[model samples]
Target: DPMVMAMLVDKMQEACQHLDRLQVRISDTRSSVLVTGDLNAGKSTFVNAILNREVVPDDQQPCTALFCEVKSVDQNDGVEEVHAIRDPEAYRRDDPTTFERLSLAHLRTVVEDNEPGYEMLKIYCRDAHGKSDSLLHNGALDISLIDSPGLNIDSMKTMALFAQQEEIDVIVFVVNAENHFTLSGREFLRTAGKEKAYLFIVVNRFDQIRRKDRCKRDVLDQIRDISPRTYAEAEHLVHFVSARKTLLNGLARSPSPMARGAMLEPASEADLADFKHLERCLRQFILEKRARSKLAPAHVYLSHLLSDLRVLLAYNAQRSARALQRLDGQRSQNEARALQLAKLRETVLDRLDDTIADTAQRVADDAERHLNRFLDHLHHIPYDVTYHGMMYLWRYADDLYRAITMRMNGLAAHIQTEAIRLSSAASSVSTVVAPPSSVSSSATTLAHRDTLGAGNVPALPELLDRAALARMARGLLPGLGALAVGLVGYARSLVAPMGAGAAASHALVTAAKRPNPLARGAFGTLAFAGTLMLFYVVADFRRPLEQQLCRAVGTHLRRTGWVRRHADATGRRAARALRQGLWRFQSDFARIQAEEAVLATQWSRERDACQQRGQRITAMTTRVAEITEQLEAINLDT
Candidate 1:
């Protein structure tokens, strides 16, 4: 009675879970399930059979071309809650034309009418039946039956994300009666083993085996070969059903009552009898076991949640590392650019100073001598003539000085532009690592919600929303763009002063006239001497200017209170968000762990607890197998 009670309890618990899920679906909006298998495995047909309706569009290729979910709603019911699970795309759902661009000849294709449907590879969710509205309304079960493209050649990594989130409960395995044990089916079985539950192998096409001898012998042999392995798993179960037949029965289109059982609606006594068996298995084994299993506590759930969180954190870390690497590389490149800009600034400044020095020396050496000679003849001429000679020399010197200054300023302006470009590059690199501002905001929101206990504890089916994640990324774009542009503008402003002098010099040159050859030759000699003075004075001053600029920027960054406030706010927000997420996952895991621990402790307390069904079953079976092997060995020795 104790053994029976345990089994009964397990079954009852499973039933409750299914009922709870159903209730949630009825109350919640977005819920989904993912169904995957090898080619010709009857996965799609099985889904259609379950709903007692044909909702999934069928295909004949080795793989399913698209991913689809079936949703239902109550027309009369009001809008309830919606639970949507975020997952990675099976194929390229992000791309509108992934189907047209990629050759899926090697992959699964969901073909309708022998023609390929647009490769719509989005995740599928089945809504509870009853309503027509924009959002999932009606107190209907939200069960998304995710129909994945055939898993034949696709990498398991491609499909691993779905299961990692704990989204699947029941896996209906459809095996063709004709080829019950294909190699593909074997591999599929191996993958199923990694799952938390045992698989139900549905034997399709029972009607096709018309001959009694063939049906009896062939089916039995196949079952015998696979049964031992199937039975070994604690939570696994098997079933014999035909989806094609089930569909016909549901449609009321079957030719005979015997065939009607295949669809699910039994029309005959035998068909009804089989339905009872299937229902029994579902209720006794699958549904009940799930309910009876101990609920995990926050800590246990946390461990598992942490595993996923670790994965997410790892992905983000990798992205950040790459971004930082790119930024560093860009910084290196910009350093070179900045260096080039600095050199240009120097060249322009030096050129302006050289021109001024050269012009001044020329005037001092040649113009001064000429003026002195003219002065020697000053007494011979009238006072007005002497004054005119002095005026001419002075006028020429001023004109030359202005000309040199103008040229220098123009060169300086060009250098300023380059500096702006370099500065822009630096700014872009600095802000590159910042997650979109919306990401920060969303993270903060999650934290705030945690404080309010939004996603904490045993956790709701709505753990993480993919749409929210995308929105957060979208929100951060504008700020980053502005930062990039501002850096470039700032670089140019730094060099604007140098250009000013050059422009003034050029303007003066435009106003001046020609000089005598002897005077020009003397001026050139004097100009060379003045060049040394300009470099010593103006060129040496740049180091101090650069230091002052750097200090100002650093001080401004420190003094601005807004940056600190935002950072503190964001940190508090992230801590809260992380805790909430951790709490939700751990609560479930902890509950389960606590239950398991209690069971373990109870087993220690009672000697009979060690005598579990699984152990007993395994030992008994092992002895039987060993006896058989010993018999064969004795016969061989004889």
Candidate 2:
């Protein structure tokens, strides 16, 4: 995005460099008249018509590939020659190395060859007409007629530079009378008209037009659209004449040694008169007002540059401000998200710990209290065991104890797992966020938003991988209990769409059908005790003895701290898992915040750059407007 800003603003920066150089050029003694128009528009013929000689080559083919600046021989120490400059930027009129010398006769070959090697050809020649009639013989000002290649042949930038060249005092736009204005011609006139407001428009080849009146009217209409001032001064500024005829007439009037084509059609009286009139007006505009005309290009360049500068400055300022706004909004969002994460770490994490601890403690207390009460009711408890013998009594008794313990443990663990699972489900969160566009350290800032985005999925805690404690109570529960557990798991899979508890009843009914092997083996002990009770009629000792054994076992398990240990282990696992989730959320949140910090730095640099550019733009705008006013205020003291 910064590149976008640079791409748009680089032109303005380059334009700024020209202002100082242009200011210096405004005070120069020499004046220049640029001759330009569409391809095959007879530009070279027009120049030849003005000078009344074939100083430049002209033909039906597209020639004049480069600029041919025609000036009086006085600048070349009264010598007529060609200075073919390969590089215009390094050109020095006095320095012989700057340009290659060629005979004046070689001008035609150079023009026709479409020389890509040279930037321009400087042609110095003498005027054959009397001093009074000669436009180039002015003693007060030196004017050079720079004939340029046709429009669309040169780049727009090069054309603009060519148009605003330091010494350009006036512009003469030539258009074919029969062809009228091409798109390139219209654009050239429009641009030239801005620089000097006044343009000398020569509608060439007038002798060729059949509908002379209509052609004039159409040309005026287009001129009015592009250059209102030229149209308003149509009588004085516009001319219709055949340049070839004028050239021929000049040959007839005062033939020069340089003139070629001795046999030529004489110019019509009307054509000669019109061209002479045009010559009179142009000579006056160029020489008489040379001092004032020199400032006009600067005035126009500044006027247009300032107008465009304002637009560019406003656009960059607005875009930079919007980018800053987005940065601020992004910063705020990052802060809010960070705070949310902090809450999870500080407040929510603590709440999770308390919830897990309370649930575990409650399960532990319930296990201890209810278990002791179950053991206390051992005398009243029912059993399906039939007395077989004393041999398997201990085996059956141990099984009965294990079954009760495992049942209680399974219930407690189920509650804990469900609680922790719900907690994890409740606390998880996933949110996606995009980072703001950033500015480069350089002056270029992205005028648009960035596509690189940020997102986070907070790691949710799951209960740590704790093995089932009830599964370890193997001896007490029948194989059917294991089967029941598996059945419950399978049922959960089938009825999962309904909910977790949907298939619980199916597991319980399946468990009820399977009788423990221990129950059948324990019946012998019960039968032996019953026979004693019948024979001696003493108080039955089975219930009291089992009660005594239950008390002893409960007391020993309590001493070992089995209940509290399970509860604490479960709580520790939940806490550890919850802590891990919190850490993960913090890690992700920190990364996002770090990116925001980088963007913040970029925004800082961007804002400063934009402000500086905006300030410079403002200063330049004011300065250019003032300079334009100053130039306009300058009066011709001549």
Per-model root-mean-square deviation over C-alphas: 39.7, 21.1
**lDDT by residue for model 1 (1-638), tens:** 69986986786576466446445533443444456656666777666655555545543444344455444434213222121213334334334433333222322223332254443433233332223311222333233456655555456634553333243444545666666666655655555444322455566555565563575456456544544444543233455555655555656753544344444434455543454465356434333443311121111222343454345445545655555565556556555655644454354333533433333333223323432333234223221112123236334333332332333233323322332332223222212222211212244331222221212111211211355334433433444444444444444333322336766667545433332455444444444434444344333332222222223322333355322433344334444433343334335444544665565455344434223433554454465456545533432111
Separately for all candidates shown, the number of backbone clashes (residues 3 or more apart, or on different chains) is 88, 11
The lDDT for every candidate, in the order shown, is 0.42, 0.64
The C-alpha TM-scores of every prediction are: 0.30, 0.61
> Model 2 over residues 290-319: C-alpha lDDT tens digits?
554666566667768767766766776677
**lDDT (0-100) at residue 98 of candidate 1?**
35
What TM-score does structure 2 among the candidates reach? Answer: 0.61
